[model samples]
Target: MGRSRPGPIRWLWYAVGGRLPDEYREWVLYDLTAPTWVLRHLCRAMVQHSVWLLLLLLPIPLTLRIWMVVTGVSVGLFFSLAFIEDASERRLIRQGFPVGLNRKIREESSGAQRSELAAMYAAYYTTEPDV
Candidate 1:
């Protein structure tokens, strides 16, 4: 029950000054020390599929080299975005986003970890003045 990416406003929220996690899985996996929770089982599943896309490229027929290359690039981009998300999360934390450190502690956690980011944003908004 989670999304695949943080929205523009969420990014903006972090960009300005908020430290809460966009996803809860990120909190448990990267922020927590034990990180035993797998609240949204699909988080790791997506990661596995992303990697599998790369591995599958090697076994295709020779005539499909172009397809393989395209597939590889797509998978690589997905991996890159995943990394970018983590990096962004770290940046948001350093910038003092609410719960930033907790988000990072979710351990390889991505967008799938958050259970109710919208509520978090609502809470965050109350603490801020309208601009």
Candidate 2:
């Protein structure tokens, strides 16, 4: 667990959007190399179903064309989020990124993050006044 940027609500925002935040992205996607389609689909379903159900249950009757369009878009968004990580990795490999690049980046960013927090706390909580 590290300090959240701006705030922690961003974690929920990224999870709902099917995108991991920067702090979590490298660990989940690269270090663990976790397959996330199932999880992302579950998240997408929660949002998509709520939206589609609202449309389906609307008092105004919808034409077949409108219904089809909504269904098509919902499916497309679900599929895209489900496979986004796999697609991103494939693209990175194609671009010739090193296999351990994520690990290296994580280490550098972690150290910088810690130091920044340390400096901030030191400044804010320091009891001794400057001469």
Per-model C-alpha lDDT, please? 0.44, 0.45
Could you give candidate 1's per-residue lDDT for residues 1-131 as a string of tens digits?
Answer: 23234466664444333454635324322322223333222233344344435545566675576667557666755674556445444544453455554443344344553334433433453364769
- List ranges where model 1 is wrong by over 4 Å: 1-71, 74-78, 81-121
* Poorest lDDT segment (10 consecutive residues) of candidate 2: 25-34
**Residue 22 in candidate 2, Cα distance off native in Å:** 4.1
Q: How far in Å is the alpha carbon of 16 misplaced in model 2?
A: 4.7
Please give, for residues 47-123, the per-residue lDDT of candidate 2 as tens digits.
Answer: 54454554555556578646855776678676756765554454334323435433334345454464443334323
TM-score of each: 0.27, 0.33
Cα distance off (Å), candidate 1, residue 35: 12
RMSD of 2: 11.3
Q: What is the C-alpha local distance difference test score of candidate 2?
A: 0.45
